[model samples]
Target: MSEPTAPQVPAIPTARRQALRQHLMNEVTRPARRPQRMLVLAPAAAVLAVVVAAGVIAQPWAPRSAPLIVPVHQGEHVGAPLLLNQMAVAAADTPPPGEGEYVYIRSRVAVAELGDGPARLGPAYEREIWIPRYERGDGLLRQPFLELPVIGVIPDRTTLPDMPPNAEVVDLPGDPDELLAKLHRERDERGRGSSRDGAAFTAIGDLLRESLLPPPTSATLYRAAARIAGVEVVRGVTDAAGRRGIAVARTEQGRRDEWIFDERTFEYLGERSYLVADTADGPAGTVLATAAVLRRAVVPERGQRP
Candidate 1:
């Protein structure tokens, strides 16, 4: 007798396909509860399975969704120069990492999902990075859990290139003016962002976030930021970890980027970005991104923690 043929499943209907796509998109933009433990990174095969199940093509470089509108809270206006000066003092006391050491930073972070739809904030996730002290040294990035449909699945841990993201220069000038000029020149060379001052402010923030700068260099960065035209102080700000503090901020292109500091100690705590006005990406007062630095220390190896 001939063998029986296997059953064939029917194809999904067009209407059902649309509904499924919408539902998956909504789920991707929904806010996620804070995870108690770090989740294991999914392998490439698993990630591919998810994409196939969703019936959507992955575009890692494209925007996933718009930012979600959040409650707006007004802050007290203060002198940016004074707050930045205090931060400079605090930064001056930080010791730089020794040679053959890595600067380890662990943080809780969230960012906006840019895509076709109303604005929404991506879920908060933990991120850890080991930045090498010397140039041409290997680094590492550990992001075990993140709901980033646009960027696709990120490996739990990955080796970094010679110059890691947001930290290109290991050494910098100690003079504020020189640092400011240098930042502007680099920004111009890259042709990034809209305004020169805004780019400089952003570059300073990027450097502050991931690198362990020398005491003088760190101090100079804050002093240099103070010289930016739109720099100001915003009070009553909170980071992703729910730590309340004041912020040194600058508004550019309908967004306000803030560097939060502890209220009592004036120590740098984290950074936040929010929408200043209603736009295509989201409504006014939407939080585009937020991060809180949980730990920073010097480690002898890439995977080791202090």
Candidate 2:
């Protein structure tokens, strides 16, 4: 009786309190019918804005997936990658020709002939080729032992009549993919029925043999060859000049083509071809052709020997 008693109120349980709070929140957040139109219009506007942004984002400079063409991996042959890398290094280390000079190359060549009866080995002869420093100049070819003219005449072979105009050594692409694509395009244009990849490899071999390229360009050629499929490691190959080395080879329909390199020095020694199957040119296992480079230098004149 000392103080006026106030009415007692029961405390709500945890569950009831949570439910009341949720109910209040829902009631406060509930949209009025009058505002529903605005809510619907706002979502539509937002969607339209998103679509417009998407269209703007679709640009040519946008990030894209990587190319589908996979690079060649080091496979069962462990030495393949190492050999190719070594060649690339050696190529980079090599020197290029000076201005107003000719590139001189000395080599030995041997070919086999398949007659109506059987295959016969042809004579192995020493040959020298001289190419001008310029892109579209004539080149000289001669055999000194045969007592040819002092000023060697430019041979028709050095002109690469079979290849396209742009397939010249100086015009070849420095990038691997571009080189390959060019090769394919040329083959198609020439109406060649051979395997495009195999033809590409052969074309690379021709470029390496018949011309003198800059160090960077030579390295690019080696890297490009490594990317081609069907190339394999051939151990214990001896070139025509009796230089022993490892080889990178490929077996096509009837021939096994090899590009030999010094095992330790990684210098390109030579290239050869052997019959894998009986063909009109030779029988199986016959050596179709062999070439070993003996010297390479820059000279003052086309016929001048280095």
Candidate 3:
């Protein structure tokens, strides 16, 4: 019998390939809030500085029992520059996990109705990702639901670049302008005809949501987000988990997409999308998607929840 030829893998456009890799591996920023869903155990001391610095703060003379910061008043807003800077500073202070471990994420998603029907809520799910420290093209991904199989055997950047077997998400530019230019270049490479501001906003959100990058990298992402045009602060928006927080959002194609953060500390909470104008398939005010990230942590192996 004749020998079989190996399958050819398509090549990803250079810029987009870079973006996709960054999107996946750099997904978590901090652990989830609730006790039952908590995956990683962070020392109270580790987060104390961040909690005090980022969140609302009480007067020094105030009783020791005082809360860290005052709750956000209705209609309060934070400018893009301020918000991003704050997040960046906090991210810069966060500690990175040790090597040779897997990043775990637990989340709940709510899918919206398009045509005058009620929205649908999807069950919570978990994702496990193993990023190799020294091995190239050996990244592993396993979803802890529906018996999804392991990935990363393939090394093609085009056909399965999103599932690339390499931990290629590090060393992102820390400069906001440089990062913005990079995203713009990638958008241009992909020939995206939409508003560059919209593209940048979406790219930043995707970056923040998908990857728990190094603090400095995460900070750089927030700063890059501040440069997007049409970005604004929205008050009183709630995440899928019903936690109310302010949002940084952009309107494109008659829909507003938002990244929500805690009202007090400004820690990233979740994200949501809703119609600003009626669409062909849905009315104005129709929501599209809402998600709450419950937890993220490094675990010892696959099939581990925390």
Candidate 4:
């Protein structure tokens, strides 16, 4: 290789150099060169200053808090907006008069919607129940008790009402058992008819509401789970509803997911099971996930996510 070459400077006119220096000095000291855009940029500067001030005092421009979705089950809105078609759920009814009461389940049912709008919820379906039977009894039974299951449908925007008492009659039917059956049927039908969903729906709604509203007795996660399940739990914490609850979850071995929720309502946090298909305007899909509390009794019939 040839010998290394030393860098050389090109000659510039002294007057040109002085002019450049003067221009730089003027830029620095000439009243800061009053930008040609003082008026154009003033509002933006003011807004930026305001935003910074707000961050210092109120955090107005700080990022918002994350959504919250605590469900009794796992996968917030992954499957579908929270809904059960038909559920054979057990409810308590009169058991032995002197002994403890046994659980009586509704043989059939249709779960209700949680929030407003048709897109978010599903239709009602049939359900059945199961209970244990077959116990030896003392001879000569006077008052035998059995709870028969009933079916119910919920009407839009309705509330449940209490059942009326049985009427006293002097006359007697030829068959007392048949009369009893007729009476029960009438009562069940009437109970269901008066309210948007009948007595059955009312009771189920009540039970769920109780399950959802909460501030657990304690702060332990296990205790919180116990509350939602309705076990006689010891040492749990209350959720927003002020009742103890066990946070229900559904997860396989290893998967990371997030539950998106409305920041204001703090309702359920969930995600759609699949990506929403695109539409003319944009990606088209309903809210796929949600967290709901029955006890909260906040089933929206027709309202926006507040």
Which candidate gets the maximum TM-score versus the true structure? Answer: 1
Q: Give a tens-digit lDDT track for model 4, residues 1-306.
A: 895332222343667545544443332111112222110111111111111111111111112222222222223332121111001111111121121211122111111121121222122122111111112111110111211111111122221112110011111232323333333454464453322212222222222221221222111212212222211211122222233432222221121112222232323322111113332212232222222232112222212111
What Cα-based lDDT does every candidate model obtain? 0.63, 0.55, 0.52, 0.21
* Superior by lDDT: candidate 3 or candidate 4: 3
Clashes of each: 11, 0, 13, 34
Between prediction 2 and prediction 3, the one with superior TM-score is 2
What ranges in model 3 sit over 4 Å off?
1-78, 113-162, 165-167
Residue-level lDDT tens digits of model 2 in 70-176: 11222234556566767898989987666546777787765443222333344566777666564445655565232111111223233221221111344556787
Q: TM-score of model 4 relative to the true fold?
A: 0.17
Candidate 3, residue 214: Cα displacement in angstroms equals: 0.5
Name the 10 consecutive residues with the lowest summed lDDT in model 3: 45-54
TM-score of 1: 0.72
How many clashing pairs in candidate 3?
A: 13
Q: What is the lDDT of residue 34 in candidate 4?
A: 20
TM-score of each: 0.72, 0.64, 0.63, 0.17
Error of model 4, residue 222, in angstroms: 4.2
